[model samples]
Target: MPDSIAPDALRRLVLPDRVHRSLYTDPAIFDLEMTRIFGRCWLFLAHESQIRAPGDFVRARLGREDVIVVRARDGRIRALVNRCTHRGAQVCQAERGNTAGFACPYHAWTFGLDGALNSVPHRQSLPPDFDLKDPRLALAAVPRVESYRGFVFGSLAPGGESLVEHLGPIAAVIDNVVDRAPDGEIEQAGGVARQEYRGNWKLHHENANDTLHPGFVHESSVSAARGDPRDYAAPAYDGHQTHTQMLSNGFGVREWQSLSLTGFPAGHSYMGGFYRGGVLSPDRDDPVWREYRARLVARHGEEKTARVLGEDRFNNLLYPNVSINAQYQQIRVVTPLAVDRTRVTAFCFRLKGAPEALFHRAVRFLTNLSSPASMILSDDIEIFERVQGGLANSEPEWLDQSRGLGADRTEAGGRTVSAGLSELPHRAQYAAWLRYMTAAA
Candidate 1:
């Protein structure tokens, strides 16, 4: 641990809510998070759909290193460093494409879909000791890469728990994400939106579950054509208003009491959101909607299906990488480039075998309504940026996250959860973060 750990790092963290500002503002700390947390953790790599066919590929970063995920001719997926063995040139320049093989643009060295060395301009001219069978000549696969449902993740460390084990309780949510479809799958549709934020990447992760900021922060959307959820939830029980912030907006009101905050090892947390969140459209006579609800009710019963569709979830951080709102068909990934700047990519998934319009509705909810381009998203981004700027102030010695004190709950596992709005997820994140930072490399 760094000397700056203020002897109070432990005391600085109060469970179920509140965290030290250092986890957000300190550069040294962010560096360690990138390694111990992101490096060791199963970081989101790409959707399996992104590489569905032979030679299809997408370049994703694990921490700061670039990795290329490709599908072999046999339809198996592989993730390997993008770096070329010859002079370390990136083997593939395009972000996404299908290819028979990848050739380094710098030296024209080629490799097959399996990342095997294919050809060199002058292979025989090279030294006899240049063994093509050597692992160094072929692309180096990442230590660990796996998919949960269709969501993919890459880890630099090999010894951590398997992807499913790390997912813990949220596995159900992941299943819920796809199982909503009659075919039990979800697909990337309507493309994706990428945005850069001038804040620590963790801010996005923390903010993913941030329920308190929506009503106050996203005033534009809340104030516009569809009045904000806060205003809507306040009095009239209209069923048409979009929850907009949905689950994350739960923090605005202090209804965390009686809620559960389930934190798992390796830093993941979730809690409950009331069913009366924002608004729900009356179940219409659409065939797909009818089938979906009927199937859900059949399997989980009306109460559970009602629970699933009724309230928005507080937020579920996928840990060190992705945060997903399964109910909303949204997943956001936070990629850190520096201590101060982070890029977030948000994607909306379509329920497999569902009506075409259902996916379009989700797209509208996300782009025009939820994401940064969305009026509410714009405001939320503003809030995150303001937090970044405010943290730079020399005026305050430290920042405070103390909220819902003494409310966090520890479960059967070494984890905790509190009210819907508690900052415990942030605290849990930092706790895991600290463990990673101080852990032996």
Candidate 2:
């Protein structure tokens, strides 16, 4: 297919610190990522809360396949192919909804919640070899579906590592995402905002862990956050309006100097605590924060809550699909539709029963600043497009990520660098990328 990675393309990607430009720009390499990286990894499916009731479902793109994840009547979540078994038409066309069973509009074929082919409109006419009881007739399930905490994940390949094994040391970070909530239960709140940006999926994924860019790129939103919104009262978008946002994005570089990286066996690496939390959403005076802290202390005790809250990281870039930002209400799921086009979904959550103001605060931070409409997000989008455009130059082919070389301290499972300023995270990411790209070799 178009995403296939050729040997020559593989040779272009210099090992360790640099990736060949073609890896980002080439359709072949992007396909390899889909197969080698996305296909094998335990891709984020959906939060358990979204499908709390049986039959609730959400449609998502897994590499090239369109799959629907639904809670079955048995209370088990199932990820089934959206394609109809008969004539190949897509089944369950709605983005998401509660359905006792999915009925194919074409030919009246129907499938049960478990993806079993329950009925075929003209079944008696079929040949003896075409058995309705055959598993092949069922909506093909994603090979493996697993959930860690309240987060759900599905994999296309059956041979790879188990979900926990793939997560490695980083699973702790994933668990932290939901466990910090009061009573260890976090709710999906606010709403989900999706936008299509003119950039490759990698740029958005990398920037999620980018503690360095917020200061410069997100200045306007920061200004809005710092500024009294009542004063501007919906000001028009101007290039300079992003001054505050850029400054906030700038805070990443300055504040994230303490990140400790730990590379794992899989292409997954955990880049620890780049941001000193309680700043954007302080736990000291904020009632929501106070309540969250009190509950956590009561449950897990002060020491554990301190550990959970103190090193609040900006995010954990879990290899291919998921970007689980530890602090705040941000969870971005990337769906790469083609070699060039990408869909980024941003979801903001409330802290269970925490204050609504906190939820509103997250909405403003995401919609006004990080959303596609935000001036800050646009700047990053501009860079990704320009970078993709330039990669087609066909001369001088590598993108340099060797910022702080020789400093990635070797730990038990992986390597790490304490200084957040170090491009240790970037190095860790590329290291993981190369391993997956060259795994078969």
Which regions of candidate 2 fall more than 4 Å away from where they truly are?
A: 1-11, 128-130, 219-247, 252-265, 269-274
* Candidate number achieving the greatest lDDT relative to the actual structure: 2
Each candidate's TM vs. the true structure? 0.86, 0.88
- Residue range 273-350, candidate 2, lDDT tens digits: 544432443444546557767777887788988887775555666777776666665677888876777887878666
lDDT of each: 0.71, 0.71
Number of clashes in model 2? 29
Candidate 1, residues 237-313, lDDT tens digits: the string is 32233543343333336553444566666787666654343233324456756776876676567887776666445
lDDT assessment of candidate 2 = 0.71
Count clashing residue pairs in model 1.
5
